[model samples]
Target: MAYVLQSDQRGIRTLTLDRPEQRNALSDALVTEVDAALEGAGADPDVRAVQLTHTGTTFCAGADLRNPPDPHALVALMRRIVALDKPVVARVTGHVRAGGLGLLASCDISAGGPGSTFALTEARIGVAPAVISLPLLPRLDRAAAARYFLTGEKFGPEEAARIGLLTLAGEDVDTALAPVLDGLRRGSPQGLAESKRLVTATVLAAFDRDGDDLVERSARLFASADAREGMTAFLERRDAAWVW
Candidate 1:
Protein backbone atom coordinates (compact mmCIF):
# COMPACT_ATOMS: atom_id res chain seq x y z
CA MET A 1 0.00 0.00 0.00
CA ALA A 2 1.11 3.56 -0.57
CA TYR A 3 2.53 5.23 2.50
CA VAL A 4 0.95 8.52 1.55
CA LEU A 5 -2.65 9.08 0.40
CA GLN A 6 -3.51 12.40 -1.23
CA SER A 7 -6.69 14.08 -2.40
CA ASP A 8 -7.58 17.56 -3.47
CA GLN A 9 -10.70 19.26 -2.10
CA ARG A 10 -11.60 22.82 -3.02
CA GLY A 11 -8.08 23.59 -4.13
CA ILE A 12 -6.69 22.27 -0.83
CA ARG A 13 -4.73 19.03 -1.13
CA THR A 14 -4.77 17.03 2.10
CA LEU A 15 -2.09 14.37 2.46
CA THR A 16 -2.91 11.58 4.89
CA LEU A 17 -0.18 9.55 6.52
CA ASP A 18 -1.34 5.94 6.03
CA ARG A 19 0.82 3.92 8.44
CA PRO A 20 -1.58 3.53 11.31
CA GLU A 21 0.02 0.40 12.75
CA GLN A 22 3.25 2.25 13.33
CA ARG A 23 1.53 5.52 14.29
CA ASN A 24 2.72 6.99 11.01
CA ALA A 25 6.43 6.79 11.65
CA LEU A 26 8.53 8.38 8.94
CA SER A 27 10.45 5.55 7.38
CA ASP A 28 12.72 6.38 4.43
CA ALA A 29 10.10 5.65 1.81
CA LEU A 30 7.46 7.52 3.81
CA VAL A 31 9.53 10.67 3.85
CA THR A 32 10.27 10.38 0.16
CA GLU A 33 6.60 9.89 -0.62
CA VAL A 34 5.65 12.86 1.52
CA ASP A 35 8.24 15.08 -0.15
CA ALA A 36 7.11 14.00 -3.54
CA ALA A 37 3.52 14.77 -2.67
CA LEU A 38 4.54 18.20 -1.48
CA GLU A 39 6.40 18.79 -4.72
CA GLY A 40 3.35 17.71 -6.72
CA ALA A 41 1.08 20.02 -4.74
CA GLY A 42 3.47 22.88 -5.33
CA ALA A 43 3.47 22.27 -9.07
CA ASP A 44 -0.27 21.83 -9.50
CA PRO A 45 -1.94 25.09 -10.43
CA ASP A 46 -5.22 23.81 -9.03
CA VAL A 47 -3.69 23.18 -5.60
CA ARG A 48 -3.55 26.49 -3.75
CA ALA A 49 -3.27 25.03 -0.22
CA VAL A 50 -2.36 21.74 1.44
CA GLN A 51 -3.38 20.00 4.63
CA LEU A 52 -1.21 17.30 6.17
CA THR A 53 -3.08 14.80 8.30
CA HIS A 54 -2.89 11.17 9.38
CA THR A 55 -5.43 8.32 9.28
CA GLY A 56 -4.94 6.88 12.77
CA THR A 57 -5.41 8.35 16.21
CA THR A 58 -2.03 9.96 16.32
CA PHE A 59 -0.69 12.51 13.90
CA CYS A 60 2.69 10.79 14.07
CA ALA A 61 4.94 9.22 16.67
CA GLY A 62 8.10 10.49 15.03
CA ALA A 63 10.72 8.50 13.07
CA ASP A 64 11.16 4.79 13.67
CA LEU A 65 14.62 3.63 14.68
CA ARG A 66 14.36 0.43 12.62
CA ASN A 67 14.47 2.72 9.58
CA PRO A 68 16.07 5.74 11.09
CA PRO A 69 15.61 9.09 9.35
CA ASP A 70 18.63 10.75 7.83
CA PRO A 71 19.33 14.29 8.94
CA HIS A 72 19.87 15.47 5.38
CA ALA A 73 16.56 14.07 4.15
CA LEU A 74 14.59 15.55 7.02
CA VAL A 75 16.22 18.91 6.52
CA ALA A 76 15.32 18.88 2.87
CA LEU A 77 11.71 17.95 3.64
CA MET A 78 11.27 20.70 6.19
CA ARG A 79 12.91 23.23 3.91
CA ARG A 80 10.37 22.37 1.25
CA ILE A 81 7.50 22.61 3.72
CA VAL A 82 8.59 26.07 4.76
CA ALA A 83 9.15 27.07 1.17
CA LEU A 84 6.08 25.49 -0.40
CA ASP A 85 4.29 27.64 -2.97
CA LYS A 86 1.00 27.50 -1.08
CA PRO A 87 -0.17 27.51 2.52
CA VAL A 88 0.05 24.17 4.34
CA VAL A 89 -1.92 23.20 7.43
CA ALA A 90 -1.07 20.36 9.77
CA ARG A 91 -4.25 18.65 10.98
CA VAL A 92 -3.24 16.82 14.12
CA THR A 93 -5.72 14.53 15.88
CA GLY A 94 -3.90 12.95 18.80
CA HIS A 95 -0.34 12.98 20.01
CA VAL A 96 2.32 14.75 17.98
CA ARG A 97 5.79 14.14 19.28
CA ALA A 98 9.47 14.63 18.50
CA GLY A 99 10.15 15.23 14.82
CA GLY A 100 6.49 14.88 13.97
CA LEU A 101 5.83 17.95 16.05
CA GLY A 102 8.46 19.57 13.85
CA LEU A 103 6.21 18.99 10.86
CA LEU A 104 3.35 20.72 12.64
CA ALA A 105 5.52 23.68 13.47
CA SER A 106 6.80 24.15 9.93
CA CYS A 107 3.37 24.41 8.38
CA ASP A 108 1.52 27.71 7.90
CA ILE A 109 -1.57 26.70 9.88
CA SER A 110 -2.13 24.01 12.55
CA ALA A 111 -5.46 22.67 13.83
CA GLY A 112 -6.03 19.72 16.14
CA GLY A 113 -8.55 17.99 18.36
CA PRO A 114 -9.26 18.89 21.93
CA GLY A 115 -7.17 17.18 24.62
CA SER A 116 -4.50 16.11 22.14
CA THR A 117 -0.96 15.91 23.50
CA PHE A 118 2.44 17.16 22.34
CA ALA A 119 6.05 16.69 23.38
CA LEU A 120 9.59 17.39 22.47
CA THR A 121 10.51 13.84 23.38
CA GLU A 122 14.09 13.46 22.14
CA ALA A 123 15.43 14.26 25.61
CA ARG A 124 13.78 11.08 26.85
CA ILE A 125 15.39 8.95 24.14
CA GLY A 126 19.02 9.99 24.37
CA VAL A 127 18.65 12.33 21.39
CA ALA A 128 18.00 15.97 20.63
CA PRO A 129 14.99 17.86 19.28
CA ALA A 130 17.26 20.08 17.20
CA VAL A 131 15.50 19.21 13.97
CA ILE A 132 12.24 20.80 15.07
CA SER A 133 13.66 23.60 17.15
CA LEU A 134 14.22 26.01 14.27
CA PRO A 135 10.52 26.02 13.40
CA LEU A 136 9.23 25.56 16.96
CA LEU A 137 11.35 28.13 18.72
CA PRO A 138 9.69 31.10 17.07
CA ARG A 139 6.24 29.85 17.99
CA LEU A 140 6.90 29.19 21.66
CA ASP A 141 6.91 31.32 24.73
CA ARG A 142 10.61 31.23 25.46
CA ALA A 143 10.53 30.39 29.16
CA ALA A 144 7.57 28.00 29.04
CA ALA A 145 8.79 25.95 26.07
CA ALA A 146 12.10 25.43 27.83
CA ARG A 147 10.37 23.31 30.45
CA TYR A 148 9.22 20.69 27.95
CA PHE A 149 12.47 20.73 25.99
CA LEU A 150 14.52 20.08 29.09
CA THR A 151 12.26 17.45 30.68
CA GLY A 152 10.61 15.80 27.66
CA GLU A 153 7.16 15.44 29.15
CA LYS A 154 3.91 14.97 27.24
CA PHE A 155 1.91 18.14 27.77
CA GLY A 156 -1.80 18.78 27.40
CA PRO A 157 -3.24 20.33 24.24
CA GLU A 158 -4.54 23.21 26.28
CA GLU A 159 -1.02 24.09 27.31
CA ALA A 160 0.37 23.35 23.89
CA ALA A 161 -2.10 25.73 22.25
CA ARG A 162 -1.71 28.26 25.02
CA ILE A 163 2.03 28.30 24.57
CA GLY A 164 1.58 28.69 20.82
CA LEU A 165 2.63 25.18 19.75
CA LEU A 166 -0.92 24.82 18.43
CA THR A 167 -2.62 27.56 16.52
CA LEU A 168 -6.09 26.07 16.99
CA ALA A 169 -7.19 23.57 19.62
CA GLY A 170 -10.85 22.96 20.44
CA GLU A 171 -13.51 20.45 19.41
CA ASP A 172 -12.65 17.83 16.77
CA VAL A 173 -9.89 18.72 14.33
CA ASP A 174 -12.31 18.99 11.43
CA THR A 175 -14.27 21.76 13.11
CA ALA A 176 -11.26 24.00 13.32
CA LEU A 177 -9.82 23.00 9.97
CA ALA A 178 -13.03 23.92 8.17
CA PRO A 179 -12.85 27.57 9.12
CA VAL A 180 -9.15 27.83 8.40
CA LEU A 181 -9.74 26.47 4.91
CA ASP A 182 -12.74 28.71 4.45
CA GLY A 183 -10.69 31.71 5.41
CA LEU A 184 -7.89 30.74 3.07
CA ARG A 185 -10.38 30.53 0.24
CA ARG A 186 -11.06 34.26 0.45
CA GLY A 187 -7.36 35.05 0.23
CA SER A 188 -5.86 35.86 -3.12
CA PRO A 189 -3.71 33.03 -4.46
CA GLN A 190 -1.11 35.42 -5.77
CA GLY A 191 -1.20 37.32 -2.54
CA LEU A 192 -0.75 34.13 -0.55
CA ALA A 193 2.21 33.19 -2.66
CA GLU A 194 3.81 36.60 -2.33
CA SER A 195 3.12 36.75 1.39
CA LYS A 196 4.53 33.28 1.98
CA ARG A 197 7.62 34.15 0.02
CA LEU A 198 8.17 37.35 1.96
CA VAL A 199 7.67 35.68 5.31
CA THR A 200 9.90 32.71 4.46
CA ALA A 201 12.55 34.97 3.05
CA THR A 202 12.54 37.11 6.17
CA VAL A 203 13.06 34.12 8.41
CA LEU A 204 15.69 32.60 6.13
CA ALA A 205 17.51 35.88 5.87
CA ALA A 206 17.82 36.07 9.62
CA PHE A 207 19.08 32.50 9.81
CA ASP A 208 21.57 33.08 7.06
CA ARG A 209 22.97 36.13 8.78
CA ASP A 210 23.24 34.22 12.04
CA GLY A 211 24.47 30.96 10.54
CA ASP A 212 27.66 31.08 12.58
CA ASP A 213 25.75 31.99 15.72
CA LEU A 214 23.44 29.01 15.33
CA VAL A 215 26.42 26.69 14.93
CA GLU A 216 28.00 28.16 18.01
CA ARG A 217 24.80 27.75 20.02
CA SER A 218 24.35 24.15 18.93
CA ALA A 219 28.01 23.27 19.47
CA ARG A 220 27.91 24.55 23.01
CA LEU A 221 24.98 22.33 23.93
CA PHE A 222 26.47 19.27 22.25
CA ALA A 223 29.64 19.82 24.24
CA SER A 224 27.86 20.59 27.49
CA ALA A 225 28.59 18.29 30.42
CA ASP A 226 24.93 18.48 31.42
CA ALA A 227 23.67 17.41 27.98
CA ARG A 228 25.92 14.36 28.16
CA GLU A 229 24.56 13.57 31.60
CA GLY A 230 20.98 13.91 30.43
CA MET A 231 21.45 11.63 27.42
CA THR A 232 23.23 9.07 29.54
CA ALA A 233 20.46 9.06 32.12
CA PHE A 234 17.83 8.63 29.43
CA LEU A 235 19.68 5.71 27.88
CA GLU A 236 20.15 4.09 31.30
CA ARG A 237 16.48 4.47 32.32
CA ARG A 238 17.30 6.88 35.06
CA ASP A 239 15.44 10.08 35.81
CA ALA A 240 16.66 13.28 34.22
CA ALA A 241 17.82 15.81 36.79
CA TRP A 242 16.74 18.83 34.81
CA VAL A 243 13.02 18.23 35.05
CA TRP A 244 11.20 21.54 34.81
Candidate 2:
Protein backbone atom coordinates (compact mmCIF):
# COMPACT_ATOMS: atom_id res chain seq x y z
CA MET A 1 0.00 0.00 0.00
CA ALA A 2 1.11 3.56 -0.62
CA TYR A 3 2.51 5.39 2.38
CA VAL A 4 0.65 8.52 1.32
CA LEU A 5 -2.66 8.89 -0.53
CA GLN A 6 -3.09 12.02 -2.64
CA SER A 7 -6.14 13.78 -4.02
CA ASP A 8 -6.78 17.25 -5.40
CA GLN A 9 -9.98 19.32 -5.26
CA ARG A 10 -10.75 23.03 -5.54
CA GLY A 11 -7.08 23.83 -6.04
CA ILE A 12 -6.16 22.11 -2.78
CA ARG A 13 -4.12 18.94 -2.79
CA THR A 14 -4.74 16.77 0.24
CA LEU A 15 -2.10 14.26 1.23
CA THR A 16 -3.26 11.68 3.73
CA LEU A 17 -0.84 9.71 5.77
CA ASP A 18 -1.81 6.05 5.29
CA ARG A 19 0.11 4.11 7.92
CA PRO A 20 -2.49 3.93 10.64
CA GLU A 21 -0.99 0.68 11.90
CA GLN A 22 2.25 2.50 12.48
CA ARG A 23 0.59 5.73 13.63
CA ASN A 24 1.96 7.30 10.48
CA ALA A 25 5.45 7.16 11.88
CA LEU A 26 8.19 8.70 9.74
CA SER A 27 10.06 5.68 8.53
CA ASP A 28 12.65 6.08 5.78
CA ALA A 29 10.25 5.08 3.01
CA LEU A 30 7.41 7.18 4.39
CA VAL A 31 9.65 10.28 4.52
CA THR A 32 10.77 9.74 0.96
CA GLU A 33 7.20 9.23 -0.23
CA VAL A 34 5.94 12.35 1.49
CA ASP A 35 8.75 14.47 0.06
CA ALA A 36 8.00 13.25 -3.43
CA ALA A 37 4.29 13.92 -2.96
CA LEU A 38 5.01 17.46 -1.83
CA GLU A 39 7.30 17.99 -4.80
CA GLY A 40 4.53 16.88 -7.14
CA ALA A 41 1.97 19.09 -5.45
CA GLY A 42 4.28 22.10 -5.71
CA ALA A 43 4.75 21.53 -9.42
CA ASP A 44 1.07 21.09 -10.27
CA PRO A 45 -0.53 24.23 -11.70
CA ASP A 46 -3.98 23.22 -10.41
CA VAL A 47 -2.66 22.97 -6.86
CA ARG A 48 -2.88 26.23 -4.94
CA ALA A 49 -2.32 24.70 -1.54
CA VAL A 50 -1.46 21.43 0.18
CA GLN A 51 -3.34 19.88 3.06
CA LEU A 52 -1.62 17.32 5.27
CA THR A 53 -3.76 15.05 7.41
CA HIS A 54 -3.64 11.47 8.60
CA THR A 55 -5.77 8.38 9.05
CA GLY A 56 -6.10 7.00 12.65
CA THR A 57 -6.32 8.20 16.23
CA THR A 58 -2.63 8.97 16.24
CA PHE A 59 -1.72 11.40 13.53
CA CYS A 60 1.97 10.69 13.79
CA ALA A 61 4.15 9.11 16.46
CA GLY A 62 7.33 10.90 15.34
CA ALA A 63 10.00 8.53 14.09
CA ASP A 64 9.83 4.80 13.62
CA LEU A 65 12.34 3.51 16.09
CA ARG A 66 12.86 0.42 13.99
CA ASN A 67 13.31 2.32 10.73
CA PRO A 68 14.17 5.92 11.44
CA PRO A 69 15.01 7.96 8.35
CA ASP A 70 18.30 9.75 7.93
CA PRO A 71 18.44 12.92 10.03
CA HIS A 72 19.42 14.91 6.95
CA ALA A 73 16.40 13.54 5.05
CA LEU A 74 14.06 14.53 7.85
CA VAL A 75 15.58 18.01 7.93
CA ALA A 76 15.21 18.32 4.18
CA LEU A 77 11.57 17.30 4.34
CA MET A 78 10.74 19.98 6.86
CA ARG A 79 12.70 22.56 4.87
CA ARG A 80 10.85 21.63 1.71
CA ILE A 81 7.51 22.23 3.39
CA VAL A 82 8.59 25.67 4.52
CA ALA A 83 10.14 26.57 1.18
CA LEU A 84 7.30 25.27 -1.01
CA ASP A 85 5.78 28.25 -2.85
CA LYS A 86 2.20 27.22 -2.19
CA PRO A 87 0.81 27.27 1.30
CA VAL A 88 1.04 24.02 3.23
CA VAL A 89 -1.68 23.54 5.83
CA ALA A 90 -1.93 20.79 8.38
CA ARG A 91 -5.33 19.41 9.34
CA VAL A 92 -4.70 17.27 12.35
CA THR A 93 -7.26 15.13 14.19
CA GLY A 94 -5.28 12.96 16.60
CA HIS A 95 -1.93 12.96 18.30
CA VAL A 96 1.45 14.26 17.07
CA ARG A 97 4.79 13.68 18.68
CA ALA A 98 8.53 14.44 18.32
CA GLY A 99 9.49 14.75 14.67
CA GLY A 100 5.80 14.97 13.75
CA LEU A 101 5.66 18.36 15.42
CA GLY A 102 8.41 19.43 13.05
CA LEU A 103 6.03 18.85 10.15
CA LEU A 104 3.38 20.91 11.92
CA ALA A 105 5.80 23.76 12.45
CA SER A 106 6.88 23.80 8.84
CA CYS A 107 3.33 24.30 7.56
CA ASP A 108 1.98 27.77 6.69
CA ILE A 109 -1.13 27.04 8.71
CA SER A 110 -2.14 24.22 11.04
CA ALA A 111 -5.49 23.40 12.54
CA GLY A 112 -6.06 20.56 14.96
CA GLY A 113 -9.21 18.98 16.31
CA PRO A 114 -9.83 19.16 20.05
CA GLY A 115 -9.11 15.44 20.22
CA SER A 116 -5.53 16.02 19.10
CA THR A 117 -2.61 15.82 21.50
CA PHE A 118 1.04 16.85 20.97
CA ALA A 119 4.47 16.47 22.46
CA LEU A 120 8.20 16.84 21.90
CA THR A 121 9.42 13.53 23.25
CA GLU A 122 13.00 13.23 22.07
CA ALA A 123 14.45 13.98 25.50
CA ARG A 124 12.76 10.89 26.87
CA ILE A 125 14.52 8.83 24.23
CA GLY A 126 17.91 10.22 25.30
CA VAL A 127 18.17 12.43 22.22
CA ALA A 128 17.37 16.04 21.57
CA PRO A 129 14.85 17.11 18.95
CA ALA A 130 17.85 18.32 16.98
CA VAL A 131 16.96 18.26 13.29
CA ILE A 132 13.35 19.17 14.03
CA SER A 133 14.41 22.15 16.10
CA LEU A 134 15.26 23.94 12.86
CA PRO A 135 11.57 24.46 12.28
CA LEU A 136 10.21 24.07 15.81
CA LEU A 137 12.35 26.43 17.83
CA PRO A 138 11.65 29.27 15.43
CA ARG A 139 7.89 28.69 15.43
CA LEU A 140 7.13 27.58 18.99
CA ASP A 141 6.90 29.60 22.17
CA ARG A 142 10.28 29.59 23.82
CA ALA A 143 9.02 28.70 27.30
CA ALA A 144 6.65 26.07 26.00
CA ALA A 145 9.38 24.51 23.89
CA ALA A 146 11.79 24.39 26.81
CA ARG A 147 9.19 22.92 29.16
CA TYR A 148 7.95 20.18 26.84
CA PHE A 149 11.37 19.48 25.36
CA LEU A 150 12.77 18.79 28.80
CA THR A 151 9.78 17.06 30.38
CA GLY A 152 8.45 15.26 27.32
CA GLU A 153 4.92 16.07 28.44
CA LYS A 154 1.87 15.64 26.24
CA PHE A 155 -0.39 18.67 25.77
CA GLY A 156 -3.79 19.20 24.23
CA PRO A 157 -4.60 21.06 21.02
CA GLU A 158 -5.50 24.30 22.77
CA GLU A 159 -2.09 24.46 24.34
CA ALA A 160 -0.49 23.54 21.07
CA ALA A 161 -2.24 26.51 19.45
CA ARG A 162 -1.39 28.84 22.30
CA ILE A 163 2.27 28.01 21.88
CA GLY A 164 2.22 28.63 18.10
CA LEU A 165 2.48 24.95 17.20
CA LEU A 166 -1.04 25.14 15.74
CA THR A 167 -2.88 27.99 14.07
CA LEU A 168 -6.13 26.96 15.68
CA ALA A 169 -7.89 24.04 17.37
CA GLY A 170 -11.58 23.30 17.11
CA GLU A 171 -14.09 20.57 17.84
CA ASP A 172 -14.18 19.74 14.14
CA VAL A 173 -11.03 20.19 12.14
CA ASP A 174 -12.72 20.39 8.74
CA THR A 175 -15.24 22.95 9.91
CA ALA A 176 -12.42 25.06 11.32
CA LEU A 177 -10.51 24.75 8.08
CA ALA A 178 -13.41 25.81 5.87
CA PRO A 179 -12.71 29.52 5.95
CA VAL A 180 -8.96 29.01 5.84
CA LEU A 181 -9.26 26.83 2.77
CA ASP A 182 -11.61 29.31 1.17
CA GLY A 183 -9.09 32.07 1.69
CA LEU A 184 -6.40 29.97 0.12
CA ARG A 185 -8.66 29.19 -2.81
CA ARG A 186 -9.41 32.84 -3.36
CA GLY A 187 -5.77 33.83 -3.36
CA SER A 188 -3.96 34.03 -6.68
CA PRO A 189 -1.00 31.69 -6.89
CA GLN A 190 1.49 34.55 -7.03
CA GLY A 191 -0.09 36.35 -4.09
CA LEU A 192 -0.13 33.21 -1.97
CA ALA A 193 3.41 32.28 -2.94
CA GLU A 194 4.77 35.73 -2.08
CA SER A 195 2.82 35.81 1.19
CA LYS A 196 4.13 32.41 2.19
CA ARG A 197 7.66 33.42 1.28
CA LEU A 198 7.43 36.46 3.51
CA VAL A 199 6.23 34.51 6.52
CA THR A 200 8.55 31.51 6.14
CA ALA A 201 11.74 33.44 5.50
CA THR A 202 13.01 33.05 9.04
CA VAL A 203 12.27 29.34 9.13
CA LEU A 204 14.02 28.74 5.82
CA ALA A 205 16.98 30.73 7.08
CA ALA A 206 17.17 28.50 10.12
CA PHE A 207 17.34 25.47 7.88
CA ASP A 208 20.00 27.07 5.75
CA ARG A 209 22.22 28.02 8.66
CA ASP A 210 21.81 25.24 11.21
CA GLY A 211 20.45 22.26 9.33
CA ASP A 212 23.65 20.37 8.68
CA ASP A 213 24.92 20.84 12.23
CA LEU A 214 21.64 19.71 13.69
CA VAL A 215 21.50 16.63 11.49
CA GLU A 216 24.94 15.66 12.72
CA ARG A 217 23.89 16.23 16.30
CA SER A 218 20.79 14.11 15.79
CA ALA A 219 22.74 11.24 14.25
CA ARG A 220 25.26 11.29 17.05
CA LEU A 221 22.55 11.22 19.71
CA PHE A 222 20.74 8.34 18.07
CA ALA A 223 23.95 6.38 18.04
CA SER A 224 24.75 6.94 21.70
CA ALA A 225 24.51 4.31 24.41
CA ASP A 226 21.69 6.12 26.19
CA ALA A 227 19.56 6.35 23.05
CA ARG A 228 20.20 2.70 22.30
CA GLU A 229 18.99 1.72 25.76
CA GLY A 230 16.01 4.01 25.57
CA MET A 231 14.94 2.78 22.17
CA THR A 232 15.36 -0.81 23.22
CA ALA A 233 13.35 -0.29 26.40
CA PHE A 234 10.60 1.47 24.47
CA LEU A 235 10.37 -1.33 21.89
CA GLU A 236 10.34 -3.90 24.70
CA ARG A 237 7.50 -2.09 26.43
CA ARG A 238 9.47 -1.14 29.48
CA ASP A 239 11.04 1.93 31.07
CA ALA A 240 14.51 3.10 30.22
CA ALA A 241 17.29 2.43 32.73
CA TRP A 242 17.08 5.83 34.35
CA VAL A 243 13.32 5.93 34.56
CA TRP A 244 12.12 5.70 38.11
* Best candidate (score: TM-score): 2
Error of 1 at 126 (Å): 1.8
Instruction: Estimate TM-scores for all models.
Output: 0.84, 0.99
lDDT of 2 by residue, 1-244 (tens): 5999999899999999999999999999999999999999999999999999999988889999999898888988999999999999999999999999998888889999988999888888799988888888887899998899999999999999899999989999999999999999999999999988889888888899999888888889999999999899889998899998
> What is every candidate's alpha-carbon RMSD to the true fold?
3.6, 0.7
**How many clashes in candidate 2?**
0
On a 0 to 100 scale, what is the lDDT of residue 189 in model 1?
84
Q: Per-residue lDDT of 176-220 in model 1, one digit per residue for the tens?
A: 788889887777889899888876775455444553554455456
Candidate 2: where is the Cα deviation over 4 Å? none
After superposition of all CA atoms, the RMSD between model 1 and the true structure is 3.6
- Model 1 earns a TM-score of 0.84
